[model samples]
Target: MAEDLAREEPRFPPAEADVLVPLVPARREGGAHRVRFGLAYLALAAVAGAALGTTVVVLDRPGKTAGPEWSSWQPSGDRDAHPRQIADHVSQRYRRPSGTQLVAVTYAGEPQVQQVPLSAVAIQTGGDGSDSPPKFVQIENGLMYNLCGLGPSCAFPEGELSEGGLQLLRREALELALYSFKYAGADSVIALLPPNVGNQQDPDDDTSRTLFFQKRDLARELERPLRTTLLAPEQPQPAEIDPDEGLIIDRLTQPRLFQYEIRQAQEGSAFLILAPLVGG
Candidate 1:
């Protein structure tokens, strides 16, 4: 009975082959989903590269630098930073030692005068001398009176300065004026030469020679350092004068000396009266 039962159970053929069924569908390599993912990856990479490039460019760009501090003289406060103080500083710094005379070449057919250190510096602040700093912007349209002479009388001997000597004197005056304009923040500077005093009692009897400088007139020269500008070449002689040398001649060599006066008005306001001397 056991042998008959076993033969009956083994009658089915090797039980059907095992079959496997996947849970999800298979995808192709070049399918739309794969292409979309590749494009998104490339776009992200491109955006990252662009951002990095922009950062590098911004880091490499140059930036503006601050201007130089030209003078060692610093004011105690803004209230003390006035043209008069600047002038005083300049006069003290540039005062010539006793018994030293400035020498220069003599030119024919030119007036002669002696060159000396600055004696005093006066400021016309377009005010009644009460304001600490003038109410108006004097740097734009102000007058700096630089007095040059030997004594309180501020008189110079006649025929002591040749044309070249005068030119040298003018150079000195210009240097002072430049320093005043730079440190004092003035736009205009007038350097007054000592008057040819016939009488020692009255020094103002004669018209004093003058040299005027304006900031706008010296735009090119001001771009350089004060030392380089001061070391400019000597003035050319009349024979060596160039037509294009108008700046050098008008500013340094043959500056027309004008006589100026501060006339007080009836209302207490003062006005500057400028007139060209007869032979300026």
Candidate 2:
């Protein structure tokens, strides 16, 4: 499944900026390069099966970014019957083009895919609001993207993308959605991260920008040391923001994301990755 989610996550590196408080710049443009955020109404598909192994087929395609814009994102589902007659993990529902809901729920179905060794490259600052300096233009294979417009009234459609091209698509779509939360069995996965990953939340609430996720012990070896927020002391927070837990960041646009909901917890069910901002 994408080489088992890139061998269980730990590949952070795409410019890394993580700005916490340095805002006040919201622009509005009509989908030229496109920027709706909320994955523009959903339609993800995945396929792989020789004799019943990886048969992911979440329905929905024809979005944007020229038909292929995924620096990195994991989450797919589609099941009606036959895949070895389905075993576990089910709550399937897929039909949210404008709402009415029908994405039952299937995490352990078709995720855990990674192919960002480096190909969809594109780096160039001054996206289009040119003042002078802010250039890093580089699109090796080309087909790059940067759509952001949600969360705390976010935005980022001035020229296309800058801030390292939406930090390599929000750090490969938030660690490939936390490396598919133990095969999406659910039990905590919250993310809204962007702004080049690190410190952001100033007039945005939900307990300092919701991202209470946890999952890092496949063997434990990944290190970056910036996280330190269990929350206490009447927590007002923001003394140098940039210590995230699962994922939560958005300078503007690219927060057009989704994924969450699954109650029942004594010590389980907490998949709440937040980032819904890309509508009408």
Candidate 3:
């Protein structure tokens, strides 16, 4: 199967990403949700945007750097960067056709752009049993989010799922969740949540159904928290606003980084055990 993916034609040019997975209800509420594994059988896999438009601010900053590994891996921070230009580039190299999902990861050398079936990651949209293919995607090992937004410059703080807002995102071992897009900003990476994961009424509300837990507990659920980011929301570039004149254009336009295209890459595996929470 891996070889088959390697042989597939390269889709859109390559691309942070955000992922939304619904936590299985402790006792079942809506209905029985079956995880789609029809990779032929492969396997798989935030918040609403209301607060996004208001004059809200993020307190956290990118202070704690994981290492040089990720410092150079994020999208370039050049002040004049335009999301459209980046999207154009990504669309050319990484975008995939129907039923196919593109995952950007580093195996041993160059960042290998592997094609996995949509069933490998997303669940059936429930409306239709057909598989919903995810657009191009790139992921990091650490938990990622925007700290604050002040005009064109948005804050993307790399942290963990220990706080109230993020703790709401925790998942069972080997379980994958999906979040719908909450807010897409010029400065912040696009926010997403499972259609049914959180409060379905609003679809973009983050404070709903929130839970808090010990930092170590979160660390335990994600055995390799820093080495893998779930595959779902595509990463955003600077100046990429969610609701704008180009809303349609941006949603379909994939994002790519000019810097990483040619450099040696160190991304983690797209499909990992994402082990169970053994202990805090």
**Winning model by TM-score:** 1
The most accurate candidate by lDDT is 1
Q: Residue 244 in candidate 2 has what lDDT?
A: 48
lDDT assessment of candidate 1: 0.48
Better of 1 and 2 by lDDT: 1
Candidate-wise lDDT, in order? 0.48, 0.28, 0.23
The parts of candidate 1 lying over 4 Å away from their true place are 1-43, 64-141, 156-162, 179-187, 197-206, 212-256, 260-264, 270-273, 278-280
TM-score of candidate 1 to 2 decimals: 0.48
lDDT by residue for model 2 (1-280), tens: 4453322222334654885643754445534324543343232111113212322222222345553322122334642222212211111111122332211222222211132222111122332444544222221211111222332234322333333333333433333233333234433333333232222222222121212233432113113211222111121112322444213344222433332222232343222223333310
Q: How do these models rank on TM-score, best leading?
A: 1, 2, 3
Q: What is the full ranking by lDDT, best candidate first?
A: 1, 2, 3
Cα deviation of 187, candidate 1, in Å: 4.4
TM-score per prediction, in order, is: 0.48, 0.18, 0.16
* Winner of 2 and 3 under lDDT: 2
- Candidate 1 lDDT over 46-139, as tens digits, reads 7767766766676676889867654435434563245555445444433222334332111111111232222222333343434443222123
What's the CA RMSD for each of the models?
20.5, 36.4, 35.0
Q: Model 3 TM-score?
A: 0.16
